[model samples]
Target: MVLSAVLLFGASSVTSLNGVFAQDSVDEISESVGDTVDNAASDISDAVTDEESESTTQEHGEMVHDDEGRLPGNIKIEREPTYKVGDDVQINATHMPGMEGAEGTVIAAFDTTAYEISYTPTDDSEPIENHRWIVQEEIAEAADQEDADAPFEVGDEVTVEAYHMPGMEGATATIDAVNETTVYLVDYIDTESGEEVINHKWVTEDELATLDGAEETAPATSESTTESSEDESESEESSSDEESGSESDSTPEENSDEESSEESTPEESSSQDSSSEETE
Candidate 1:
């Protein structure tokens, strides 16, 4: 009977141990399925994020607008783009953030045809005039030019109908302003201390930030020219007046001498007449 009881206890213990092992296996299977589901959800989330990013980038029409026309930090510089090509138009908007006040040169104007060109800006140690900005498009060039007989001014906006940038052409950009003056295609070094910006990109007008009073100095020199001209005119007038005075003074002396000579002649004749009478 004792041997039988011991055998029974051992058999029960073995069965329980096996049952526990089977339970652990089932638990592991359940855990693995949960992990798989979690992984799938994570992958789906990642895909959604990627799609959103793509959608965002696909927007070529969306403008990053600043109502005050303030420039974003990404923009390194801003200036009025001289319309070296387009006809005169009103500046209606700003490009590249902080460019609302940027002046553009009207290279050409079209009645309904949008003027566009490609340029690579030689900036940032890279030859990149590739920055082509549409000067005018979808607007009456004649009408706009008639409006501003002088030059391009601020508050004008224009759309691009050409392909300068990926979607730049035909993509509308505002005319920051219109400026009529000498636009310079120039090369220069940046004044900013250490940007390593060998050739920076920015279209400037006649009246942006004055470096060493460049524009002002020109006017000052012009004023000096005017003053010199005026002085020359005055000197000429004074010379004429002096000549006239000298002529007048000199004529009086000559006339007086002539009168004295005539009077003396008369007196001498009279003296001769009196002597002849006395002798008679």
Candidate 2:
């Protein structure tokens, strides 16, 4: 009886130890799974925050030309503009890539409301902040809204119809500031790409300067000189041809007179010979 009791106690102790180890393993596995889930959730939250932050960062496309025509006719120049239409000026501002140091031709100028805005893109991508120079006419009013001519104040939310950059149109934007200065539409060559950018919008007077010694100015002057030289060359050629024609036409008459004089000399010589023979 004693032996059997001892054997039973040993078997019971082993089973208890096995149960404790199994419970510990289960607890450790549960803790590892919890940690993994927490980490995954944190990573997802961080990614979302990062995406939202990136959306608001100011980024633009290389080309943003839609809504780039003239401003409204009602918008007049409030003061004399520093640069006039058809003036070639150097760009001092870099509103887009490759704008600074580029040569621009002024196409239009008008004094109207300009705005700095922050907006979410229409495609629901990242938001853009502090975008410059979206004009008053570029904002699309809500259908029910009144007061079309009123300028927007800071913190006012409006929909942008201007495609100042890609995904900018139809975006809801908050006005950050307003300016009542003359804005110019211009054509410029991309110094980097050498491509022509036409009817670029909203460059303020402060952003332009006289194009003294700019890269394009030198080439234009050289071309003008080449044209002038060509004209002079053509004129000289024409004058020389006229002079040659006159000399040739006069040469024929002189030759005919010389031939007549030679024939008369021969006749005089024959008469002298006949007189000499009669004398002999």
lDDT of 2: 0.80
Q: Judged by lDDT against the true structure, how good is candidate 1?
A: 0.44
> Model 2, stretches more than 4 Å misplaced?
1-62, 66-80, 141-149, 213-280
User: Whole-model Cα lDDT per candidate?
Assistant: 0.44, 0.80
Give the TM-score comparing model 2 with the true structure, all chains together. 0.49
lDDT of 1 by residue, 1-280 (tens): 9999999999999999999999999999999999999999999999999998887544321322112322112221214333334322223233333333333334322221112233222222222222323233222232357542223334344443333224443343444434323322222222222111111122334223333434557889999999999999999999999999999999989999999999899889999999999999
Note the residue pairs that clash in candidate 2. Answer: 55-126, 55-127, 56-127
- Please provide, for model 2 over 158-242, each residue's C-alpha lDDT reduced to its tens digit, 9 standing for 90 to 100: 9888765677778889998888678888888877767787888778888889887665678899999999999999999999999
lDDT of 2 at 70: 40
Off by over 4 Å in 1: 1-94, 97-161, 167-212, 237-241, 264-280
The all-Cα superposition gives candidate 2 an RMSD in Å to the true structure of 9.9
TM-score, candidate 1, is 0.32
